[model samples]
Target chain A: MSEIINSPLLWKGAVVTLQLTLYSAVLALILAFFFGLLGSSRHGWARAIGRFYVEFFRGLPALVLMFWFFYSLPLVGIRFETMVAGVLALGLNYGAYGAEVVRGSINAVPTAQYEATVALNMLPRQRMWRVLLPQAVPLMLPPFGNLLIELLKATAIVSLITISDLMFRAQQLRASTGKGTEVFLVVLVMYFVMAQILQLLIRYLERRSERILGRRPRRRAATAIAGTTGTGSLSGVGGEGS
Target chain B: MPSSDTMSEVPTPEDPQGAPMDKTAADGALPHGSTPGIRFEKVVKRFGDNIVLRELNFTVAPGERVTLIGPSGSGKTTILRLLMTLEKLDDGVIWIGDRPLWHMPRGDGLAPANEKHLHEMRKQVGMVFQQFNLFPNMNVLRNLIEGPVRVLGLSKDEAVERARELLDMVGLVDKIDAHPTQLSGGQQQRVAIARALAMQPKVLLLDEVTSALDPELVVGVQDLLRDIARASDLTLLCVTHEMHFAKDISDRVLMFDKGQIVEEGPPEQIFGEPTEQRTRDFLQAILAT
Candidate 1:
């Protein structure tokens, strides 16, 4: 247990794992927004292109994609480093899934919100940026959090591609120390810890968005305490008043 | 990505005629008791196989207050939606301030209006929905100021100042920083009204604005709207189930059934001395509940 905990090789592997997750996560997020917007675009060609990318990448398994990019592409004289290939595979794969999440979240914003923007005579760009995207973001957060955790777990597949990620280090430790159980348990705990951190980060973002959007009940609590603040009534003049 | 660049391709035949009218109808330029007149000529709208508005010919005078009353699915709300440019016209033309809405002039023929034309026409109109579609992502102040700041090109300070005035007019100045969810249904509706007014539109369309409010809350929104109507020369088109609100707000009441006007007259003639049996039936059916 002590050796597993103190192994410099394991620490190095963990650092590499963190780097891969961060880099690929960023890549996936950017592609998600790009393809997602295209998927929801009004243009026929843009939506078709978005659909093609999402379906093509999502149909292939991430490990197979890594192998193709790393091995098959080199045969055609188009080669990538092991880390680059792993990142591209993971990013493209998760990005396709994330694109669906983005599109769904944008659609989930009620039609009336769109109408409100139009009623205000907002340009299409203003409507999406100011009203649509801000509202869609909170809806996207929970699903995106799930995807992030999945991506963290999926990084283990990179170990098969000669990346010295945490799982790779664990395997080497198991072979040399002949203590598969101890080494694997430590690796499992490390993954769990990383997942928990991601969850915490996502939760913080969700709370912050709620605060900004006023979706949180903080104002309601305040309104209740302040009793007569919003109680102004218009009960006279027209017979329409209850 | 929707741009007005296509407008350059389409000849602005209405430009010569639309310019002067636009100047008078521009933000805060119209006289207190007059704005723009809306004319619909043979306008038709269909939802799938269901024809909603069939050869709908109607004209609203400048600063006139008109209420469209009909039973559910009579296409009363559809008329407001058309004017707001929320729904496309299946056939015919809609004129806002003497300019065609669904069509643009092109080489001695009417071409279907592009996104740019639709957007340009939209700025002249504002609408209040039954559900009070206030942007829940923004506070009352932000909601009121968003249109002015973004579309109207006012600075933040100027928009805020205008928003404060409008909120004070609607009596929600205290809740400027409060979220839509925190307010009551009536409060939210007021915010929606103020939000619409911040744009200073020439034509105001109210589509069942009070339908979603609590019974106790309906009066407040109605009262606020009544004050607004009396004070501004905005050409007002309203759709409502409330008979008294219809009577109070409308100078003329158009009773509709099956995509056509069954009867139209002063509120007194329509509600008190209805000439058409369908109008009486719709009134009785609405008032009974």
Candidate 2:
């Protein structure tokens, strides 16, 4: 158990896993907003394209997508590095699910809000950005937090594409030491810790979004203590759902 | 259909005796060379299988304070909504000032107005809703300034200054930084009124603005509206069940029934001696409650 915990190789692999999670999360988030906005768009062609992307990616398993990107694409004269292939597969898959979250959050904004924007003579873009999206932020946070953690867990699948992630390192260590249980258990705890960290980050963002939107009371004391904290971190996924 | 002394020269389509409902009130209150405040030329609006408004022909003279008093589902609120562009007109044209609302000149003929045309027309109008519809995400000050800065192209500082003045007018300056959710229903509605005023709209539509308030709170809002009516040359189209408020504010009171005006005159004639039985019954039922 000590050796499994102490292994420098395992730490390196954990770094690789963390890198995968971060990169894939970023890609997924961009795609999520793109497809989500498109899916609910007034234009039929945009909605069709958005729907097709979401259904296509969501219907396929993340691991199978990784394999296709890694192996099959190369055979068809399209090549990607191992990590790039893994990130793309995970991003495309998770993004589809996140798009639903985005769409649902946007729709959940009251009809009255839209009407008010119209009454104010807001252009379509202004209505979405200024009114609809700001209101939708608090609603999008919790679900996105969940999706982010799910994306974190899904990074384990990158091991199959020979990315040398935490899961892959654990198998290698188990093979060398002939101790499957110890190696697996340590890796499990590592993954769990990473997920917990991600969850805490998301919770912080949810509170920040609520505060900005004035749905929750502004914690003057906390603001004083944590002086000048910027809202840059969650601007994409947590900024506005709708 | 004898014209009231204070009534503007609005063309009355349903008048048995074709009173020249032109832009010439006997009181001479209407300005010369000004466009009609609002005019519906054989307008029709239907919802699904239900016809809400049927060839609703009426006109509100510029700067005239008109009240649409009717029972629920009589299409009084629908008229306000149509002017505000919240509802699509199924047929005919609605003119706001000199411009057609739902249609625009295309070559030698008229076509359905596109978004840009509608937006330009909407800029001249504002509305206060029953629900207040203040943006929950924004504070009172932000709500007031949003339209001015965004749509009216006022500088942020100019918008804020205007917002402060409007907030002061509405008696909500103290609550400027407060969220819409934090204010009472009446306070929220005041903020909504201020928000609308920030746009400096020429035509104001009031759709039961006090209906959603608590009974005790309705009076204050009505008094504020009365003050606004007294102060501005704005064309006011009001839909309210509050007969006393309607009487206080409206120069011409229209009694609507089944999507048509059953009677219209000065407040005294409509309230004291309604020519139509429908108008009498509706007023009796409403006033009794």
Candidate 3:
């Protein structure tokens, strides 16, 4: 483990792996929001296009996409760096799943919120940014966190494109030292540690989002109000104004 | 039909001077002379095959406070929804001030309003929902100031000042910085009221505004609404099941059934001596429960 940590090549590979994950994750997040909102659009054509994109990418394996972009694309005169190809493939692949998460979360925002914004005379853009998205974000975070971890593990596939990520370095070390078990074990632990760190970061973000949305602990006054007002019967009627 | 005063300007289908029968008036000219605060002429609405409103015709004079009372699914709330432009009219037109709410002047005819036209017309009206749909993402202060700052083009300081005054009016000045979920349902409704008022709309639509409150909390919101009704000359069109509140706040009370107005009269006459058997039956059933 110590030797693996000390190896300059391994460190370089680890850095590349982290960079790939970070870049691709960001790209995937952007695509997720774009396609997710498109999927939920009121226009049938927009929804159909979004659906086609999501299904096309999600249906193909991530490795095949990487290979196609890296190898086959150059044959068609569309060349890209190995890292760029890897990032694009991963981003597009995971983004398909992420779009579904986003679409569901946005839909989960209560219809009343939409009505409230309309009643306020807010434009569609203003309503989405200020009212709808803020409420939907907290619900999206957990699923997003899961996807991030999966994408981190999926970075291993980039090694097939000749990118020297952590998995590629581990394979090289195993071939040179003939110590397959130790090398693979070290690589596995490293990946586990990275995933754990991501989990903690995502958990912190979820809590922060909850705090911002006032979905955390109820204030004493609110609880007291609830107590005085009673439950079920009283609160049920309370929404009559909607 | 209970009183001539309430029935005075109710338009008939053949009333030529009512909504222009000519669908081809594309001059973009604002109608001249005194227009009622709101007028619904032969307005028809439907949800697929389920018709919600049928040939609805009514006029609320400027500053009139009208309350609609009806059984569940009687389309009272639909009326408020239509006035707020939350629902589309299947046929006919809604007039606000001197302009049509659902149509804009095209080259030689009226066209269904686009987003730009709807945004412009929405400025003249505001609504308070039954659910107290305050933006939970913002605090009480931000909620109150959002429309004034964004829509009304008020500076931050001016908007904040106006918000503070409204919060005070709603008797929730202390909750200015608190998040919406931290307030009681009644408190939230008050904030919603103050939020609507912040827009400075000429007309306010209240859709069962007090219906969602705890029975105990109902009075507080009702009293707040009463104060607002008395203090402002803003035209109010409300849908509610609260008889006493309708009696106290409404100049005119309209009893609706299915999708049409069964009877309408002054609050005294409507509640005291409803002419329609349907109206009396509804009043009896509601008051009994």
Candidate 4:
């Protein structure tokens, strides 16, 4: 524990790791959007091509893809920086899975919503932007929150690609100081705190969407109040509004 | 995913034309009413092997209240969908005022209009659904304001003010900030109708808008629609199984079965003195239920 306090490198490494996770998550989300849209389209060839992408990347292990991009792309004359390779590989791979989640949410929207849009004579883009996507957000939010947490965990893999992120620095300190237990223990607590914050974000989004789009779950206190008020009135008809 | 990017292919001339069209005798517009509401010309619609409309035709005069009644799959909803331009026609032409929708008259042939044409055509029509497809993400007030602000380009201040007025009309002024999920089926459907009215569409298409409502709530929705139909100049093309409401509000009732219009007349003649056996059978079946 004292070693972590003395090592400025460890703090900087934690910051770097957080940044990598943020960048990769954003990249993954953008790619997943188009992939999901294409995957959901009506054209046979278009959907087939999108399906191939979903299956190919989703089937590969995250570690395997990161290593392959880290080592193998030079063969194709595409030499990304280690940091870029790490983020891009993870983002693209997870994007494939995210696309399916997005598409599933889009499908879960009732056809009646679609028919209403049609009846409005809304343009195709208008129907998607105004009617469909808005509803899909509530459906997509919970699943996407899960993926974001996974991506945060995934940032740990970038250390293998030789990026000086938190985990990499943790490893370096472990080797130099031979305090494996202390280093990992500190990072584990840090991870637990990060996960707690991430869960708080998920809950906030869930509540916001529950208010905006999802089924209105009843609050127990409100129900209790109503029941008590009913019984009180029954017991005393003179119970006044005042 | 059930969703599809249905826009990809350039339609070829495998069929004479890809979409259908129906024509009405294009009456010169009344001096006061500049916009021709909706006219159909020999309109035919098919879903793959199933034909929903066949050589069908009807014209809705501006400010007319036309009720389309038929058994399930009688193409009533399909007609509303066609007017909304949600479904492409198999053949025939549809017109809104002087403009042709569904199919554009191309060089010696007809082509489905580009996305731009579709956008321009959408401005004049509004629809309310039976299932109440209010934007679940928006509160009642926002749901009313969204179309006016986004598609109509109304200022947000003006839109909110008008939204409040429309909410008042639907008798849900108290529920303006309520999320759609918080409203009952009746309340939500009423809001849906008001949202459509907020756009001030030249024609309003109501597709079985009350059929999905609970029995207790149906009357409330029907009363709201009746008020609108009585008060406004908006032409209405309503597909409904509510025979009593349809009879009371409709100027003319079009009775349909299979893929064709079996009979159409003033509501009294069609509902009371039916000339077609199919129309009579439909009325009996619905009334019994």
Highest TM-score against the true fold, candidate: 1
Q: Which residue pairs collide, candidate 2? A: B9-B22, B10-B21, B11-B21
- Please report how far candidate 3 places residue B67 from its true position, in Å: 0.6
lDDT of 4 by residue, A105-210 (tens): 8888888787766655565677787878778877787788888888888888889889999899999999998989999998887766776778678756755665
Provide backbone clash counts, one per model.
Answer: 0, 3, 9, 16
Model 2's DockQ score = 0.48
Q: Which ten residues in a row have the lowest lDDT in candidate 4 chain B?
A: B23-32
* Per-residue C-alpha lDDT of model 2 across residues B1-289, encoded as one tens digit per residue: 4333223355533322332233311112211233247888878899998998887777887777889998899899999888888899999789887789999999987899999999999988889999999988888888988888888899999888778777777788899899887888999999998888778778889999999999999999998888777666678899998999999888889988777777898898999898888888898898788
- Which of the two candidates, 1 or 3, achieves a greater DockQ against the reference? 1
C-alpha positional error of residue B223 in candidate 1 after TM-score superposition, expressed in Å: 1.1
Write one digit per residue (lDDT tens) for candidate 1, span B185-212.
Answer: 9999988988888888889999999999
lDDT of 3 by residue, A1-242 (tens): 66766777677888898999999999999999999989988789989988988999999999999999999999999999999999999999999999999889989999988888887888888788888888899889989999999999999999998999999998999888877888888888889999988988886787677668877642343355577675433322332222
Docking class of 3: acceptable
List iRMS (one decimal) for every candidate: 3.8, 3.3, 3.1, 5.2
Q: Which candidate is the best by DockQ?
A: 2
TM-score computed on alpha carbons, candidate 1: 0.89
Scored against the true structure, residue B235 in model 1 reaches a CA lDDT of: 85
In model 1, how large is the Cα lDDT of residue B58? 78
